[model samples]
Target: MELALSLGDTPKPFSLLDHHSGSQQQKMKDLGFCMGLGSTRNLEDLHIKNMMREKDDEKVISCSSSSDPSSSPPPLPLQLDLLPFSPVLKSPPPPPPPSLSHRPFPWLSKNLIVESGSQSKLVKVIDAKPLTTVSDGEELAAGEYSSPNNSNSGTSSFQMDFSSIFNGGRSFNSRKRDLELSVNLELVDATERDHRACSRGGGGMSDEDENGLTRKKLRLTKEQSAFLEDSFKEHNTLNPKQKQALAKQLNLRPRQVEVWFQNRRARTKLKQTEVDCEYLKRCCETLTEENRRLQKELQELRALKTNQPYYMQMPATTLTMCPSCERVATTTTSTTTTSPCQQAPPTGSHGL
Candidate 1:
């Protein structure tokens, strides 16, 4: 006897044979997926057999459009038809699948655009200036230096010669970022130490190093580099105060801390977006399951009502399971009568 197929029933595996133009037709007579002239007419079945075609076309298009003309598209695979033991059965409408949430990250450009004929036109406005060599105990730049005449300090202004800060220097140059970072570290340390000690702390330090005559390249260990990267993810865009505190904790310079935080913030925002997407996906799945269950219950109730007699004058409540017996029975003014509709015995348990 032929086994009848229903919605969601799995079909027996069958062989797929393929025949096409410009290719020798081959017979796939084994029990595998079939795709050709007389295959299962079910759209889903056909889709399964021809799945490779979808991917194959993409490769063909990409090959045809290649910059080199020697590249040729591969020959299409032949279709196979699986013989069915019985007539094709109509399938039930499938529950709509939940859509997945796609999370995309913002991309940062790694390439820097250098303008033509203007490589040296832009001045590097960073660590080039010496932080320690400022005249007197007060070595503040024009923008950074506040008036000593302010009520906070209540002192007269003194001329701190800053002309030497960039004196005898090339007009515009781009040193390696690491070298600039080293300069920033030395200047911030020397200035901060001197401010606290109230004494010039340049006794052992060389004048050339202080005067930017010699630039030192700084390097970080693997562990230090990894730690800084992790730290920056927690704190983004630190100010002077925050930078100092972070540097104290990490034993790194404020400049290094600042750069790390900048990079970290960008990464954190991207990570947060991905996390949000996963959460939304779980929520979508939960909602989908709930919707499916509710739809199934509604269909069952509708089926039960349709089978009832039209003149029975049974209330809709009769369609519900009995409170005590948990059976589909209708209560009337005269008496409660159990319908021909019988609920499946609660699994293995028989009625009392």
Candidate 2:
């Protein structure tokens, strides 16, 4: 007879070969009973086969259960092998930025003109008058002796006497003695008047006035001041030759030019110091503001940490146990719904 089996309520014809051997026919019968054929002996054999299949499946499950999913071995590391002749790509370095020179004093920007010929003429003028070494008493006496002689002098004789006194050819003692011997009453009175005049009119005073106790302050002319300012702008410091040239140009002593340059340098330094101080003050203010802002942000973060909910901060995993097998399992969930492992077991043959 040709046997037909239904799978899921659909009937299909099942057939064995017409020339099948007994052992092969018996094997087909066994397979048919396992697919729900109603035969007592064949059903017993099918039951035994089902039991063996169940045991094998249980063994496979036990092996899988022995190793934990959480304890799975890390994935194999990916090896990167470099190929020969393969070009390596690299980013080129950025070009350097343009450099700027530092200028501390911005106001000193003018160029100075140094005239070589003018400087030479100044040196010649300074060399012409050697500073007098004669004492004040001798100078006074010499002046008195020359007073009467200068009145009559359209002559070579007067020029000779004047030269003899001033040219340093005669000794101071000889000049003083000659003045006292020829000193008339009128001349003595005239000397006293001249002494009074010298005291009253400080201008055009002799070298004795320069050597006196009082310090003389020389005022520079506006043109001289302007020239010095231009020179100072070109170079803060002066060489000896430059100093002498400037002094001659300004009709000032070399000492005066040296003092002016020293003062100018000091003023420039003071101005630079003030600028630096202002810059530092602004930087300090900016840092202080940044610090205050950071402190406020830190306080807000700390407050947020204190006020956050405890449940919101908990980890995503919860311990769970299977209802049918009572096996322990770890579950990761976002919601409060019970997982499949914690659900009630089904009724009837579906319990496994």
lDDT of each: 0.31, 0.34
lDDT by residue (tens digit), candidate 2, 15-111 = 2121234563344333322122211212332221222221011110000111111222311211111111111112222221211111011111111
**What is the C-alpha lDDT profile of model 1 across 246-287, one tens digit per residue?**
443333445555666665555654553454344335544654
User: How high is the lDDT of residue 304 in model 2?
Assistant: 80
Clashing pairs in 2: none
Q: Which candidate should be chosen as best, given TM-score against the real structure?
A: 2
Residue 165 of model 1, lDDT score = 19
Best by lDDT: 2
The whole-model C-alpha lDDT of candidate 2 against the native structure comes to 0.34
Which RMSD does model 2 reach against the true structure?
42.5
